[model samples]
Target: MIVRIMGEGQVRLDDVHLAELDELDDELLAETRSGDEEGFRRTLGALLDAVRRLGAPLPDDALEPSELILPSPDATLPEVREMLKDTDGLIPG
Candidate 1:
C-alpha cells in the first residue's frame, strides 16, 4: 500500500502492516474525539514514525496515488478532526 504523509514524501508499505497501522489509526481517532491534544500529538507522531520505520520511502518524484493520506507531523487537532470527518481514519479497514 502506498501511504502519504502530508508535507513529507510517500512511503510504500506492505499489506501486512495494515493491521498494526489500523490500531494506531484507531488510537488517533479516539484521541481526536476526546479532545486530548497531548495524546493526539503523541499518537500521530507514533503513527507517522511507524510508517517511516516500517515502510520504504518512495522517491520524491514518484507520482503514484497514495492509498492512505496521513496528517503532517505538526497538524493541529482541529485540522485532523476536519480530515477525519471526510473519511475513515488514516487507514481504511
Candidate 2:
C-alpha cells in the first residue's frame, strides 16, 4: 500500500507490514484519546519511522493515490485529533 506522510511525500509499504502498522495505529488512537501528548508524539514518530524504514520512498514525480495518509512529524495533537475524527486511525482496516 502507498502511504503518504503529509509534508514529506509518499512511500510504498508492503501489505505484509499492515498488521504491525495497525498495532501502532491503535496505540496512536489511544494516545490521542487519552490526551497523552508525549505518548502520542512517540508513537507517531515510531509509526512514521517504521514507514520510512520499511517502505520504499516513491519518486518525487510519482502521482499514485495514497492508501493511507499520516500526519506530519510536527503535527499538533489537536490537528491529529481532528484528522482521526474523520477516519478510523491512519490506516483503513
Candidate 3:
C-alpha cells in the first residue's frame, strides 16, 4: 500500500518501503563513511524519489517552482530552500 502524508503532517511510509528505506539509509550511511560512490548514488536517488513523491507536482507541469507558492506570500525562504536542497538535485525539470 502506498503511504500518504497529508499537508502539515509527518510523512509515513508503508512497512515494506520503510524497511527497504531503512536498509538503504543504513547502506547510505555506510557508503558515505566508506566513500562508496555507487552506493551513495543509489541511496540518495531512492530517498530523493521518496521525498519528491511526497510533495512534488506532476512532471508534466512546465512551470514548477522550487517551492510551490501557497496562499502565504510571507512564507519563509529558508525553509523552502531547505526542502529543495534536500532533493539534492534529484528533481527533474
Candidate 4:
C-alpha cells in the first residue's frame, strides 16, 4: 500500500507491516476517544516513525494516489477528528 505523510511525499508499505500499523491505529483511536493530548502526540509520533522506518519513500514528483493519508505532527485534535470522520475507516488495512 502507498501511504502519504501530508506535507511529505509518499511511502510504500507491504502487508508485513499492516499488523503493527493496525495496533498503532488502535492506539490513535483510543487517544482520540479519551482526548489525551500527550498520549495522542506520543502515539502519533510512533505511528509516523514506524511508517517512515518501514516504508520506502516515493519521490515528490510521484503522482500516484496514496492509499492512506496520515496527519502531520503538528495536526490539532480537531483537525484529526475531522479527518477521521471523513475517512471511511481506520487506515490499517
Candidate 5:
C-alpha cells in the first residue's frame, strides 16, 4: 500500500503492516471522538510516526496514487475531524 503524509513525500507500505496501522488509526479516531486534545496530538503523531517507521519512503518524484493519506503532525483537531468524516478509516481502507 502507498501512504502519503500530507506535505511530506509518499511511502510504500506492505500489506503486512495494515493491521498495525489499523490499530493506530482506531486510536486516532477515538482520541478525536473523545475530544482529548493531548491524546489527539500524541496519537496522531504516533500514527504518522509509525507509518514512517514501518514503511519505506518513496522517491521525491514518485507519482503513484496513495492508498492512505494521513494528516501531518501539526494538523489540528478540526482538520482531523474533517478527515475522519470520510468514513474510510484513518488509513482509508
Candidate 6:
C-alpha cells in the first residue's frame, strides 16, 4: 500500500532519497541499525542488472559495442559535430 501510494506520487522524492528508500525496504534508516544483508544484496544485484539491461545495445548484427547510434532521423552538421567532439575519433562522421 505504501509503495503504491509512493509510486503514485503522493509525496515528492529525489533520486538519492528514492535509492535509500529502496535500500531500506521498511527497515530503520540509521547507519548503525542492523539490516537484512541478504535481502539488500539481492535487491541491489537485481537493480544493477536492470540498469545494465536498460543500457544494452539494440539487436543489430553490424552494431559494435562502442557505437553511438543516434535516434534522430536527420542530424544537422552542428549536431553531428557536437556529438563527435566528446567521442574524438570513435565516429567517422
Best by TM-score: 1
| Structural similarity to truth (TM-score) of each candidate | 0.96, 0.95, 0.37, 0.91, 0.93, 0.26
RMSD of each: 0.9, 0.9, 11.8, 1.6, 1.2, 18.9
Can you list the residue pairs that collide in candidate 1?
none
- Residues 23-74 of candidate 2 have per-residue lDDT tens digits of 9999999999899999999999999999999999999999899988899999
The lowest-lDDT stretch of 10 consecutive residues in candidate 4 is 84-93
Candidate 5 stretches with Cα past 4 Å from truth are 86-88
Q: List candidate 4 stretches off by more than 4 Å.
A: 86-89
Name the candidate that leads on lDDT.
Answer: 1
Q: Could you give me the TM-score of model 5 versus the true structure? A: 0.93
Candidates 1 and 4 compared by lDDT, better number: 1
Scored by CA lDDT, what does every candidate get?
Answer: 0.94, 0.93, 0.41, 0.84, 0.88, 0.31
Tens-digit lDDT string for candidate 1 (14-69) = 99998998999999999998999999999999999999999999999999999888
Q: Give the Cα error of residue 27 in candidate 1, in Å.
A: 0.6
The residue pairs found clashing in candidate 5 are none
Q: Report model 3's TM-score to 2 decimal places.
A: 0.37
lDDT by residue (1-93, candidate 4, tens digit) is 899888888999987998898898888877877789989899888989999999999888997888888999888777777777754336745
Clashing pairs in model 3, backbone N/Cα/C closer than 3 A: none
Backbone clashes in each candidate structure, one number apiece? 0, 0, 0, 0, 0, 0
- Runs in model 2 deviating more than 4 A are none
In model 6, what lDDT does residue 24 have?
A: 34
Q: Write the per-residue lDDT of candidate 6 for residues 1-93, one digit (tens) a residue.
A: 011121111222233334443443222112112344444345434433333333433343322333222313233334434543544221122
Candidate 5 RMSD to the correct structure:
1.2
Question: 2-93, model 3: which lDDT tens digit per residue?
Answer: 22222322333334455545554555555555666666666656654565454434334233233321112222334323434444321222
